[model samples]
Target: MASQRGRLTMGLVLILLAMTALAGRALQLQAIEAPAYASSAASKIQRAYTLHPDRGQIVDRNGTVLAASEPAVLIFADPLMISRNGIDERVSMGPLETQKAAAAPKAIAKILAKHLGGRPEDYRQMVTKTESDGSLARYALVRRHVPSYTYDLIKKDLAAGKWYGISATQDAVRSYPSGTVASNVIGFVNSEGQGGAGLEYALNKQLAGTEGKESYEASTYGRIPLGRATLAPAVNGTYYTLTLDATMQLTTQKALASAVASTGAESGEAIVMNVKTGEVLAMASMPTYDSSNLSAATSNEMVNHAIQDSYEPGSVQKVLTMAALTDQGLVTPDSRVDVPASISSGGGTIKDAFSHGSLALTARGVIAYSSNIGTTLLTRKMDKATFIKYLKSFGLGATTGIGLPGEAKGSVPTASMPDFTRDQISFGQGLSVTAIQEAAAVAGIVNGGVYHSPTIIKSARNGQGEAVKVPVSTSRRVISAKASAEVRNMMEAVVTLEPSRAVAGYRTIGKTGTAQRIDPSCHCYRGYTASYVGIGPAENPSILTYVVLNNPVKGHEGSGVALPVAQQILSVALPRYGVEPSTSKPPKAVLEYQP
Candidate 1:
């Protein structure tokens, strides 16, 4: 009886312990660990995929495609299929089976390396990466922007199961078809498919479209079966239409290239603007680059000098001073002023290009001859406040809003500055102005002294193909029509008919600039900036052109170097735009003073 009771007690205790253990395990799984296990299971089955949106085309005014996005592909892989360690299912395997599984990627790598130009060993590492759990990685990058032929070869292999786990998606590669023509204006996209510089950088927001997304049930082997997917479609980028004329832009670039080589200039820039409409017809810079391969481009090659750089503008600014004198009725082209060859103000001497002691000149003569001393004397008639006001009215000391990135607002001295600063700035010194700013300011004189902001983008279209309206221009009348006429007449005298750079049949008006360059490090005079700003068809001017040569080694005078370039661009542009020769005879220039 005692032995029976002992056996029964032992069996009852064993049964209680077993029941308690089972209950605890059930509680842990159903209550404590349920959420975590559920999350892990969902993670193993579901994934969210990114969809890339299509970028837009950048075209010229006449539908010439300057920049566009071409079809491309981005290659990816399913880690489970490519990586031995990525297989989640446990299977009993022998040594030979394991060895064969490990060597599969090596075979695939050899095939990929043949087309991609990388070593098979390097590719082997990319395909065999694993997760923390020693399972195959879910995703891997192969290549981006693969050409059609290369992608086709890989796709064929993938379809035949010659390579497992590889896949590709539709993508785009940005291309500049014109190839180095207007590259500075068009800019380039970077390796990551983002706009890096120039208009590419400026209009990136409009050009880079919205990214799309899709969520679906994918197989453990990394295949999307298609019907279970939910997609949020991508919105494409807006198309850009620039005001640049392709033919004229090419002409201007060739002219700049020839000028930079012939004159041995460090760099050069040229701008052709519509005097009446403020349209930037063509802007060109030397040392330009191929926007396709910016990685090889230098700092100089990347800059859009026409709008980004500012120089002293030299005597090209004298036209503005002459116009100011005529506008206020303080002087006229006929009014005479006694001027010395050199004058002293603010303890600094201002001299002409040539010394003529106690000379007399009309206000127009000051501009026609580009006499610095004469212009300085003319400023004496107006107060400092009025003079500075006139400068602002002409769009100086501010950006011209030419729809480009990295535009510079050229510097101007304060109205209350010393007489030396005043004198120098009055004749295009002691101040900085960009080529576009000078062009727009000259355009003011061309458009009857009404200032209009310069623009490069002619029009634009949204992704939905809706026309995007350009911003309404804010223009203000700076001078009367009569004053602008006299200024144009004076400038016309600067470029005469016989033995002149002006196209024989067309009437021309211009100003020359030979300003000393200020070194950035020492702030001292170094080389020279030779420049010329001209207007044509003097009876009713239509176009305004500006050319600037930096540190010309061969010539120091504007007439010698810069004038020829200005004439070259205008001679081609005028005829291309169908501008006719002046029917009337050239007007007589009364350069001699009559007191």
Candidate 2:
């Protein structure tokens, strides 16, 4: 009897202990860990947050907004909401509960079908299929990249519960006000709002502002109170005011296109820079791409030719060589030189366009005639070292430090140069340079011998209209005033004396060159690169224009083809800049030559 009682007591005690442990577990689950699990369950029920970014804007110099951003709506769905409403189970039943399951789907279909521009049956199929699988797909996108009108309609439908599981949050998108004007320079962004090319690529970091964060508490339905929110707004991108003038850019583009088409040439490029300040008033290339539709054009056509392509600058380089020689006082406008029909150098014979055999030529006459022999004789007066030094000083074989991307620093032959190579280089051979380099060098010659580093960005400005002056390098006197005057005078005579090739009523000064194009296969001269460089108002030069035509078909010459283009551009650009005709006559010191 005693043992039975003891066993019974122990059994009762064990049962009580087991019941107590079970009760404790129930309390812990319902009280202590309940909030965390409930919050997790709520999170799974609906989206807790939406990310929005402030889209960037691109503006012009005159505060005309080229590109802007506007608020937009983003659409999404909530799977948990549909599941809680038993829409999932009903939809999953297929043909059996198809009627009930499809009721909600049909409602969603009818509401969203118009927005998506899809058939009601299609929307039903898409919504039912997604709901059945307990999945939330942004089915049918019910309007992506939505505008304001569409957003209003969708919002009203959501408020009426006509479309379950649908939601929209605020977002921003890019807008271009000027349309395709200056498109190539302003550039565009990808869908993710990242800049790709042109000023966009050049100033990406500044344009792409710092992104911010949003942290907030939400209800089980993942819908926040209409007003209650903890939010951090994104910092908007900085505005860029370009140096490009929309009207001037358009005019230049039109001219370039006309010239390229009329010449029957492959392509062409042109730039109009301010002589006093290196502000690029107009820069353009033919076969340009629309920044809005850049992908539509080929890569070759999209490149900025003014800064990228390098060719034998031909007689354009003569400006530099003459500037160098005259600066050193080794040759003056009247300095006499013996013209040879052809001179042998580097296993090749350099010949003039039209040979002047054993004739007496003045320093200015050598330039006027573009005599390979006369210029060579003059360069022989200066050793190779001095010549190379002057070339460097003129920014040859180097970058122009123009802020554009893909700029080419052209080459000057530095290896295995024989004594004869000096003569070839003196007349703008055995060297290659970019159009910008040539333009900047010529600008130096005409702009009082000061070579100001070329610039495209006018000034870096802040939001307050206060600009931090981006200091341009001080213009250095690369040549004396007298030398500049002499070369300037000679160039003027080339245009005036050759009136048939000159623009009437314009005092233009320039040189024409036709350099033999090197044969890729044998490294011999097989074709020609034609170029003409000119400066206007020869007495007091204002604009320096360089036009180069490469490998022209049907035997083209610089004087015949390229000079005409230079004249056309000057006639139009000079009058546009309001530069008056020079009353001063061509300097009598110009040594006349018959080329």
Candidate 3:
């Protein structure tokens, strides 16, 4: 009887121990591990995706679109979905078994290839792709920026329940309606819809809007209908209104292209600036490729030559030299100087374009005739320190601050420069300058001496059409107003000397330049750069046009190759912008002085 009681006690004790262990396990599960398990379950049911915002439109001052973003879709593949469906396993079994694995993938790839312009094999490879770790890839990009209409057709097939891993999301593709027009300035976009060059790349941050996030409850298949969700709305990019006039830009490009072709020139650049406002109405680079078809473009053709290329301005730079001399009272338009056929400086003989005996000519006559010897003789009167200072004040040795990518700051001769180098720079040989820099410097000389920094962007607005303030271009005085007027008068004499430069019904003034081109291959001068910089209605200069042709085999003179292009642009731009023709002719310049 005692043994039976002890066995009963042992059985009670065992039952109590078992109850305590069960209670402990329940507490641990309910208190310690419950949150982690709950989180794991939630993760399986919730998902988040990025919502891309619309990129901005780049438009001209008059609201003409230059670069725009069009609606499209990004097609993607979920290889993990293919793996989950057992197609991956079948694909590993060599097309023998029912060929079901190869069949599904082939069908999907074929459909994708038909809609998109890719090979079926390529798509199939992506669909069956694996990760770097030897596991099936969860995601793969089939194509980006696919046309929306094309995506629609693919979606129809997907809705038919055939396509398993194929999917698409709304996206954008950049479009250039003007084709190659202003391509060098507007730039192009890459396949990923990112700015690849020019203004597009420089202002990419403002052009590319902010992306947002969207999270929602999703099952193994897809997002649940009316499931719990959270969203952060995206902000679209700002619309940039540039100072470029689309019409003028097209006209300038056509003229420049024709000149380049007719002259058999390597390449060319042109810029039209508003003398008063410093607005760049047109900036054209020739041999430009269509931004829409970037693969066909060469690296040389993609350059923004107006701002990127720095070359010897030849005589076009003489405008600044003459302006500086006039401002310093070192020379006057009517002052007379006896010019020789050739003058020796730093072991180099500087000669005029035409060989002539000693002749007496006024300062205005020296500029109009483009006498190199005469210019050098006059430049020698100024000290090196003063001359270099004047060059800097005219916006040389620095960038024009036009706010474009890859802009070059053309170098200027300094106080330490050799005497011969200084003399060469006086007539635009030793110095290097960009087309835009030259244009702006001339504008400063003719625009009452106030140097306005060049600018392409005029205004900016948000996606909601609200104006965003853009900093105004900086301006400073570079010369006296009287000096500017005198220089304008002197340039007017140049047009008088060459009737070909004169635009009918308007009094024009400009200088022609022919400088030996520097070849990068040898770092030596090989060819000539013919250029012309002109301003119209000389009494009150309104517009300045600068054109330069590189290595023209035929008609290598500036007047022959570059002047016609400048005239063509001015003929349209001046009237188009409503700068009235001159009612009275400019004062007659006394070219020669009789002793």
lDDT (Cα) of model 2:
0.69
Tens-digit lDDT string for candidate 2 (39-74): 786554443444555555665556667676778776
Q: Candidate 1: RMSD over Cα atoms?
A: 3.2
TM-score for each candidate, following the candidate numbering: 0.91, 0.81, 0.92
Query: What lDDT would candidate 1 get against the real structure?
Result: 0.82
Between prediction 2 and prediction 3, the one with superior lDDT is: 3
Q: Name the regions of candidate 1 deviating beyond 4 angstroms.
A: 1-40, 84-100, 132-134, 158-161, 220-227, 469-472
Flag regions of model 3 displaced more than 4 Å.
1-23, 83-106, 125-139, 464-466
Quality of model 3 by C-alpha lDDT: 0.87
Backbone N/Cα/C clashes per model: 3, 1, 0
Clashes of 3: 0
Q: In order, what is each prediction's RMSD in angstroms? A: 3.2, 5.1, 3.6
Q: Better model by TM-score, 1 or 2?
A: 1
Which candidate wins on TM-score?
A: 3
TM-score of 2: 0.81
How high is the CA lDDT of each candidate model? 0.82, 0.69, 0.87
lDDT of 1 by residue, 1-595 (tens): 9999999999999999999999999999889999999878767777676777778898888899999988888877666666542343456656865665576687777778887887988787667777788876767788877876788887676556544677777778889999998999999988888888888888898898888887776654564676356788777888988888988899889888888888888888999988778888899988899998877899988888898888898898888877787899987887787887688978878888886878777776777778888888888788878888888888889887776889999988888887778888889898899998888888887688787788888888877899877653468899999899888888877887325767767887888889899989998999999988777878888877788988888887887788888888888877777889889866787776655
User: Model 3 RMSD to the real structure?
Assistant: 3.6
